[model samples]
Target chain A: METPLIRLVNVHKRFGNKTVLRGISLDIMEGKTTAIIGKSGEGKSVLLKHIIGLMQPNGGEILYREKPIKEMSREETRVFRNKMSYMFQGCALFDSLNIFENIALPLKEGTQLSPSEIKKMVGERLRQLDLEGTENQYPSQISGGMMKRVAMARALVTNPELVLFDEPTTGLDPIRKNAVHSMIASYQKELGFTALVVSHEIPDIFHIAQNIIMLDEGQIVFSGSSEEIQTCETPVVRQFLRGEAGSMFID
Target chain B: MTMHESPTQGSGILHSLGAIVLYRIQLAGHFTLFLAAGFYHIFSWPIQIRKILQQVYFIGAKSLLVIFLTALFTGMVLGLQGYYSLVSFGSEAFLGSAVALTLIRELGPVLTAIMVAARAGSAMTAEIGILRISEQVDALKTMNIHPVRYLFSPRLAAAIISIPLLASVFNVVGIIGGYLTGSKLLGVNPGVYFLRVESSILLSDVTGGLLKSLVFSIVVATVCCYQGYFTHRRKNSFGSKSVGLSTTSAVVQSSVLILITDYILTSILL
Candidate 1:
């Protein structure tokens, strides 16, 4: 069997009395787009956070390339983190920085790239995200959609090997949502980087994601390819798909 | 769990008291860890010279006028009071030394520290708290940048280097203010007053005052930065209200800690 790039072996997490994740064991294959879909408060974002190392699991271990994350030395941790990028749900751009500076920050802080090279790379990302002419404007001056794009631009400027996107199209309009999905598909294809996206755009997200994982109340109810999910026999998965279909044309 | 319940009442009270004590211990432990984190990143790679300079400008250079005014008024009042009290004993000539010694040995460092804590310290807390609430700090971590290195370390370095220098400025301006009042205005001999002032001050006094200021700067910076950095953990508040609470707690705790540290340091040094 081929080695999976990222593996979770019975991971668990709880906050106070609330258990957010319960014994989550999953594999994320390399160079593939895996979309995790679930209802609200079903631990989709929490799972993404654990993968990104923002929060620690109360139990079990997370492995990247078959090496546990906690065992990595400081240098190894930095190298490990450098391979991945996370697009936050809230588009957490620095309010103090202009658009260009926000996108250029990861490179400036993490890489040995010369100033001109950083500027060139950031400019390319801005152009790709269609965020031109807003380089000098701060995040406050931009709209929510523009801020989302700027955040995506920031996450991609580092040219990471793995990108974890948390709700990249959460609040966008249908046109922008499809556009963003298309962007991710094109970028993943062109860059050959693994993309792990957590979103609920239903059929739109499923179109771009090759594999899908559905979580119902902290456990993976179904995990399979996009084509396979349509034929999934699990009750919750079937109900979820039915519900998704019900809302397809209603709103 | 109600207080009037018979069997559980005593256990409940004990539990509540134990929880409070444990909470205090946890707070102390967390603050210690925050301090360690702040100091550990002080020598991190790619020295952040620009950010330190910006903080220096905010903490030191911008505080000059306020320090001068506060010190001048303090010294003038001391000189005036000293002259009046000494005239009856035929010791009016000691007015300069009185003003100079008080300002240099005690008032200068304490006032400068309090002023900086009120101004730059509050701003630091508010900014970091806002960053914590907004997830900008988490974003920094995701990008492999340590938030302490990017934020707290620069402010720490700046406050350490700036507050002592500002205290010295305070001492100079205060002595000058005393001279204007005691010698020029209160009719003490200019030569005698300055000679007494020069004679009374020792090297130990200046160094001791600088040391006190250094300690105050560390406490203030650590408290303010720690409070702001942990704003997300606050139980009773969230969002901008938590930011406001953090800022208020930073300033209040810094002020109280500065005075307490002053007394402790003074007793030890004395």
Candidate 2:
């Protein structure tokens, strides 16, 4: 299938005794938006982490562009990392650095860009994210939504081929959530980069995601187009789509 | 199972002791590996000179006033006490030797390290622990940055380079404090006071103190950084309470290790 941009083959991960991801296999297409939807604490984040080689799976393999991540040489891994970025849930901006420096850090460290060039690129990204005048402020001084947008700015500053979002709209209000959704949608359309987002925000994320993967109890119960997800009849898929706490004492 | 039906108190105590020993061994191994990695990264390519300078400012330049004040008061007190004790034996001329020796040999390095452990060391732990909790360290890894090299090697290099310098400053100020009290306030002959200090202080004493300060700096930086780096691996929730606990543990562990290492170095050097 056009040699998926990223693929996970029966990935398994466990922390001590608790298995967070159990044999999850999936493929993410190039230049498409895929949303992984699951209940809280159901391994959505863990699955995302495996894709970027952040956390190695206990078993199975993760492949990027048909190459196993585990077998990449040091130089190859570095190139792989530079080509992708993961936007943390909390923004994870360096507290000691201002927003401008934070966004400029990857470009400064990874590329041979000069100071003026780095500044210009950071300024452009900030403006694109509607964070124009907040360059001089620290992460602590910004609101939650603004912090997320700034983080997105930082993530896209390098113009990566892939971006992983970990719960991009967890604690925001509806307005902020929609803002984030629209921002991601617009950026993906313009940039045409593959986006893999892990979230439990149903219809909001579904609006932007071309494909939906539902994870439950460390397993991918369903993976299909957004329209198929809406009509899927599997019990867990139906319950998750409807946002219902299924009957507890059902026979 | 009722409390009374649980294992005997003796077994529980043994288990607790065993756990403590195991935990300490694990910590020691972790610290050794961390230090080895730090040393390795020191020689690796892409040395970040700017970060090292910033850390030097944080760990050294910013600590000047407190170190100065501490050295001054300690030396003054030593001079006052030494003069009084020597006067009873009609050997008050030895007061300068006593103050200079005490300041240069022991108090300078030990007290400076203690102060730094409380100040910069704790701050480093807290900062890194917060970074771990907020996943900034993880973000660094994803960006192909070695967290140890980017976050810690600079601090280690800065501490090693700054502690000796700070200790030297402490020694100088302390000697001045001692001179002010012994020769001026105590009515001693200034010539004898200065002469005794010159004759009594040996190269070994100064070098020994510098050596101790160097060792203490490594201990403090390594222990504090190890604590912070592992804070995220803790089983508890990654929150403010965990960070606070890690900070306290880093300071206490590093401070205690400093004193212990000081004693060992003294026993060996002296």
Candidate 3:
């Protein structure tokens, strides 16, 4: 069997008295899109954060390319970070930078590309994202959908090996959601990079994700293909699928 | 039961007081650690010259006008007050010496630092706090950039480089303002006024004031940056209100620390 590109071994995370992730163990295959779906406050974003070494697990270890992130040296960690990119839920574009400058930042800071070379790459990424003629605009000037596209362009500008997305389609209209979903699908196909997306959009995200993992109250309740999820008779899963508050409501 | 309840009330008061003390001590410890981390990165190779220059422009050049105006008015008031008091003793010729000595030793550095703490330091706190709230700082970290190296060190380094220069400018402008008031306005004779100032002011006094300004700038920058960087870590609810509170606390803490540091330096230097 091929070794997984990333592995989480019994990962656990807690904030204060609240336990966020309770012993999560999973394997992320190479060059595949995995979607994590959960109700609000279920640690899906926290789990994604652990994969990128942004937040450390309280217990257990994360392996990037089969090497433990904890054991990586500073130079190794820097290289690991360069190979991965994270798109924040709120876009997290630098307020001080324009769209072009925002997209150009990682390339300018992380790579040895010349100014013209950087410009060429950034321009190409912009065109790919359908963001032409919006270079000088600040993030606030653009609509939410455009901001998400700009963020996506920035995350992909470096052509990283793994992209971690935190709710990329949240708060977007269905049209914008479709645009983002298609954008992610096209980019994953063309770039051939592994993607881990944390999203709440149900049936829509199912189309893009090859594998789905459902988290509830910090534990993995289900992990399988989308078809398996559809046929699964789990009560929590059924309630979540129907978008209803089941008998498990807590006051 | 009543005796037990009385003991419980007494312990509750003690516990509350102890918690407050512990909280303050923890905050101080965190601030010291933050300052140490910033200093550690200061000597790292590949210095960000562009960022340093940008901070210097923001902290120094931008503060020039306010410092100039403040010094001018302060000197004029000092000259007016000193001339009148000295005239009572027939020692009005010492007006320039009083003005120059007061400014060089105490007023210039203290007032300039307070102004900077109010203006530039508050701005640094607000900007960084906003960045923290908006997750830009996290974004920087995920991009493999050290937030302290990219943010705090530059501002700290710039403030250290600029504060002394600003204080010197304040001194110069203040002396001119005093001269205009005492010599040109009050007819104390420019020669005697300048002579008294030159004779009374020592090199050590000027150097000491500049040293105080340097320390004050570091305090302001460190406090402001620490507050901003740890906005999310604060116990309060995380939002714009928290950022506002951090900004206010930064200014208050920096200004208070400046005054306290001034006292300690004065005690040691004098």
Leading candidate by DockQ:
1
Give model 1's TM-score for chain A to 2 decimal places. 0.95
List, residue by residue over B150-212, the lDDT tens digit for candidate 3. 889999999999989999999988988898888888989999989998999999999999999
**Residue range A85-170, candidate 2, lDDT tens digits:** 99998888999899998999888877889999999999999889889889899988999988899889988999999999999988
Candidate 2 local lDDT, B40-140, one digit each (tens): 78767778788889999999999999999999999888889999999999999998899889988899999999899889999999899989888999888
Q: Ten-residue segment with the worst summed lDDT in candidate 1 chain B?
A: B1-10
Per-residue lDDT of model 1, residues B142-244, tens digit only: 9999898999999999999999999999999998888888988988898998999899999999999999999999998999999899999999999999999
Whole-model lDDT values for every prediction: 0.91, 0.89, 0.91
Pairs with steric clashes in candidate 1: none
lDDT of 1: 0.91
Clashing pairs in 3: none
**Residue-wise lDDT of candidate 1 within A141-221, one digit each (tens)?**
998889989998998888889999999998888888888899999999998999999988877788999889999878999
